[model samples]
Target: MTNHIIVTIGRQFGSGGHEIGNKLAERLDIPLYDRNLVNMAAEQMKISPDAAEEVDETGLSRFLAYYASAPVDYSSYYMTNIEMGQPLSEQLYQVQSEIIKRLAGRSSCVIVGRCADSLLADEPNLINVFITASKEDRVKRIVEKYGLTERKAAERIKKIDRERRYYYELHTGKDWGSIESHDMLLNVSAMGIDGAVDALEALYKAKK
Candidate 1:
């Protein structure tokens, strides 16, 4: 059995997934990959970070459709043009997937979002987790974190969740947030961030 483990976390918008991931990584003494993933991919692809973020999870379908019909050699010439090649979203996914794999190979780490669960699904020591909270709790969290009103936070939550669902399903051909899609599903609202981290740590120890 492999000694290294990778923890992939998929989360609802206001579920404190980021915080949980940070704590888990800190406790485990491993790196945490989150938004920095975009920066890394941007650097690898030689594109601006802003450009990568714009298309991150929102452009997967268009990229897939374009690539499916485009010629295999299309990237050879198009890649030269910053905005003319494969969709930025697709490029970001490809670059980040490679980075995620490389990171897992080097050491155990906690990765939040960017479809890391699906990207590393085949790894023997991978633990795929989905973090969520009740709608009420999520809304309250979003309001406090983003300084948004209750109505605005609720809207933002729906929008982000929809984008995430589309991106994950598009890439993995699996239902996002479904019990079967993850090895473990956690409710941050009920478990709290520390509780969730402890639960994951226990699971990891048992797996080891």
Candidate 2:
């Protein structure tokens, strides 16, 4: 409804997906919605942004052990014996979808992750992209960027990828990272972020 070119980026873990999304927004002079969405959702839900961010991107419930494992008490501390009943990840997904829809309607912005590609599937002017890289490249990048040990970096990357894929599959019932879901699928390890953005801009202009 806003008539702005919406870009949704899906990426492999540690592939610089968020950075590329940010850079693209800066170049286009458009708003970028990424972790800010998590923050907003967190504020709305009265939860920590850290908590929201953990469950923000990727396949649903697959990383429950790693990301969404909220602390609970089963001991005498539970005098009420009533679970606070935290919002399910699916419910959070719905909230995020609504937030994205509202944001897109008001402005042309780049949204990264959080099932945005599928959520905006009906929009005529949306460009969905999937970014990926070789596991080796991702591992190296993670190590250097996060100053993590090789083993830790590899574990982190793999865990994040799994969670993302699980989330996508759970929410959309479509395989994550499938080429069909995206209008453009680029390997940043091959072209770099700027090159990818350039190619995307060209594609959008041509489509327009």
Return the top candidate by TM-score. Answer: 1
Error of 2 at 45 (Å): 1.8
Residue-wise C-alpha lDDT for candidate 1, range 89-144, written one tens digit per residue: 67778888899888888888899998888878778988899999999999999788
The TM-scores of all predictions, comma-separated, are: 0.85, 0.83
lDDT of 2: 0.76
Worst 10 residues of 1 by lDDT: 71-80
Worst 10 residues of 2 by lDDT: 73-82
Taking the tens digit of each residue's C-alpha lDDT, what string does model 2 give over 55-163? 5664222333334365532222112213645444544567778999999888778898888988888888999999998889999998887677789778888877888
Model 1 segments beyond 4 Å from truth? 58-85
> Model 2, residue 111: what's the lDDT?
92
